[model samples]
Target chain A: MRYWLTSAFIFLLVTAFSQEPPSTGFLRHLMDREYYKEVVYLLEQTDYDDASLARKDSINYIKGWSLYSMKALQRSAGVLKSVSRESPYYLPAHFFAAYNHAHLGQYGTAGQTLDSLRLENSNMASLRAFENAGIALLQRDYKAFEDRFNQADTSYYPIKKASDKMLDFARDLESHRKKSPVVAGAMSAIVPGAGKIYAGQTGEGISAFLTAGGLGFVTWENYHKNGWKDVKTLLFGAVFAAFYGGNIYGTVVSVEITENEFQKAYDNKILFNLHIPLRNVFN
Target chain B: MFLTKVSGQPEALHRADSLFKEGAFFEASIAYERTVYLQPESKVVHRARYKKAVAYRHLHRYEDALRELDRLPLFSIADTLKSRILYETAFNHLLLDKPEEALWNFRRLEKTREEPLHSSMIPLKILILNHNRKWEEAKGTLLSLVDSMPLRPHKKQSWKDSIKSLYDEDSLPKNYSEEKAKNLSRFIPGAGHIYTGYPWEGAASFLLNGAAIGFGIHQLWYKYYFTAYITGFGIFYKSYFGGMKRAAHLAEIARHNEMKKFNDKCSAMMMRILK
Candidate 1:
């Protein structure tokens, strides 16, 4: 079918050239200009019947290119997978296949495809960028992760900035956790209020320690004076015990939350830096 | 003679109508009552009696209105017209806070009327129960009604929000009974684990404490004081902590359960109304 179309075009070209006498270079340019779309349309319309080897190669190449352009990933990957080593597009096919696999969330498959392409094309640095983006997505980095994915590789500054943001959040959270428990415990130990102040719980810590201390002092004084006749001393002791324990528990849990946040941030940074499988597309 | 009675009836009705128009309902009712009595065998007499009931109702003389309404036999009225009258009677009773009477009329009206009376019926029952402060029963009835008639608009209007409000945690005590917790823990230990959110621990403590108590009792009965003391202390410690935790936990659980039940009932009611 393609041969028939080419013959017809050639026949039309000959007649048009005979009548108008346009330059061969301009006509050649027109045919070549439609080269990509025409070939893809022919391959799509064909049912893979017995065709010439050149025609087959042309169809497959155009099919892969068309799919890549349209972002029809799986189809593009399938077409690329069949490209032979002898073909001029064998390297590009491997790269495109890896990208398609990454987009479809098949990270492992994408990594294998990229590794093969890496072996064939030693100078292709862009493959490393794709690998890093894939890694970032897996690690759940919201920031630096999508830096390599902003339509092109214009700058790595966005990735660096994002990484810095993540680092700061992590460091701040870590420092907060480190100080929280120690401050909470020290405040309570010193005078109950001190530990709460350290824990950033000014009002709560002050009230807790003061209330318990006041009750404790009152209970001791009552026990000293009235013997065991009144229940005030025993009641106050119980209240003091509960308040002290609760304050300590609250501080510990608060610090743990801060630490967890930091750990999550750090993990995200590593993932974003290594696009493990590779997935950015330039249209 | 019939014509004479009818002619005289129109004059009495005219007089009653004039008094009714003037808002002199007592006199109007009296005149209508007499007119009906004079023409007792006529349909016009029954119609006049109904009008008198309406006048009495307008004057807030519900008892008098009910009495006049009672004189018109149910069979003497057309179903459509009678349903309207019955609905009015129910509404009047409802306005007077006589829900029991209102409910009766509503039920009767419901049988004849097609527009959401069964749904309307339950709220009156709930209102009556509410008036009596039989809240739990009222809530239960509403829940049952909501569940049974999952999507009746009248039923939704009748009970959903009201039932949910009735089952609110404010209805229960903050410091609920320990016995309830014990029973719950006995079936599923840690069942009452409150403030700490550790029900498994509560259950373990309860079970271990119960076992210790059983061992202590056996040891003490057999004169093994040393063993008894160890087991007894263990039992006491576990039981005390478990009981406290369980009570606090179960209080929260019960509060949540009641709230959930209330919400479920409300949703069911709203679904009925909207559907």
Candidate 2:
């Protein structure tokens, strides 16, 4: 009787250990239904140390996807990277990790991740080429973008169409006139607001010109009427000098701000184009 | 058997309720939403919907909460549940600064309900009236509320006295007059600003007008009449009249700010009484 009872007890333990936990099933259901917040909450409360290896991978993938959905890019990348290569989810995990890095502008890391995939399929290779071109566009290396884009197989219509569009964008960017802050500053120093006009800010240029001209006229009038010995003449001269200097400095700063804004807008456009093909193919 | 039958629904609702109790409102809202999706036709769906709206309100997503409330079929619900929904809807409107809508709903509740909610509506109505700056209506409501109270003679007298004091505070005299300020500055440049309680500005205005006139006279004495007339005298005349206009503008601003403070204080006192 003792032997039979001990065997039954061991069998029950084995059955319990082999079967998936109820919570894991529930978490999967939640994730499938897009109940992301609840999935995250459940994951926080769960102790995964003793969970089976398969279950652990599933949990990490779900958590990573949840964070990604919520736009927590860095956290999503870290969690997705924790899934081992041996797991069945390894490919998707790596793909999302690279996507997250790309979204964060970590182009080099993202490129390395795609390279590690060693893509055997032409579709994936085309996708990588598109992403590489996107990276080059973000870096403002139009030549490199063209080179990478031309290497992709045109049989994939999406890649062909996207590359055509990007090539045109790159051509435009290559011919675009880039402003230099140093040049802007020098021009403004020579003639107030001239640099702003060069940077295509005609209104700001005219305003600066009017202000400095008004101050200069006031200084000249005060000195001509009251002589240099008068306090009014000296005060007006001082005001003119301060305003002239500020105008030069403001022109330089405005040029730099405009350049930065231009680059940011262009980068976002490139990133958005790169994102579309991936969603079309994968999502 | 029962647990297995309603497995996901019960667990989700329980977790949502637990989170709600812990004041994790955003998470609770999500959890409640899951329960609604899991069992849309369940008897507890109305309760879940109500709790979700409450959670959104606590999260300060007032518009979303109102949308949730609007989705509920209040006509089919129990009378007490319907009343609770109406109360929540009115309270949300009050928070959203739609005082007229809140007052209408509160009055509806008063007409339909008995005792507690009816009594509670009186204070809320008074509070809303005050918030809308209808001080006369608020005072009348307060007086009626006081008269309807079952308090002892002394307590009733105290309430009436408090209401009277509130009325007196609201009716206090104006602190600044634009006409008076303009007249003062017209006679003596900058005296109006001083009368409106800006001493430094008054001094500055006085010195500026004094300096311009002094410079004008000096230039004229030096036989530079053209420069004196065009620059010094022009500045003096403009500054003198500008000072008067500025003083009148300042007085008007001061009076506006004083009235705003008075309104804010009355609102605070009304809020305290309601609380």
Candidate number with greatest lDDT: 2
- Assess each model's interface with DockQ, reporting 2 decimals per model: 0.01, 0.12
Tens-place lDDT per residue, model 2, A21-59, is: 334344444556666766677676666678666566666
Cα lDDT of model 2 by residue, B26-67, tens digit: 878866766776788886777788888989899898887888
Q: TM-scores across all candidates?
A: 0.28, 0.75
Error of 1 at A78 (Å): 18
Q: Judging by TM-score against the true structure, name the best candidate.
A: 2
State the C-alpha RMSD over the true interface residues for candidate 2, after superposing those residues. Answer: 8.7
Candidate 1's DockQ is: 0.01
Task: Please name the candidate that would achieve the greatest DockQ relative to the true structure.
Answer: 2
Report the C-alpha lDDT of model 1 over B94-189, residue by residue, as the tens digit.
667676777678668768766554555566555545444456876777676666665667756556666566556575324344566666655544
Pairs of residues at least 3 apart in sequence or in different chains that clash in candidate 2:
none
lDDT of 1 by residue, A1-283 (tens): 2332344335434543334322222223324444343335434544544544433444465567666666678988988777666654555566667757766767678767765653433224444454544444544453534574442342443344444453454344335435567656655655755665665557876777666666556456546755657674465456666766776776666556555665555555544443222222221
Model 1 chain B, poorest ten-residue lDDT window?
A: B1-10
- Determine which window of 10 residues in candidate 2 chain B has minimal summed lDDT: B1-10
Clashes of each: 23, 0
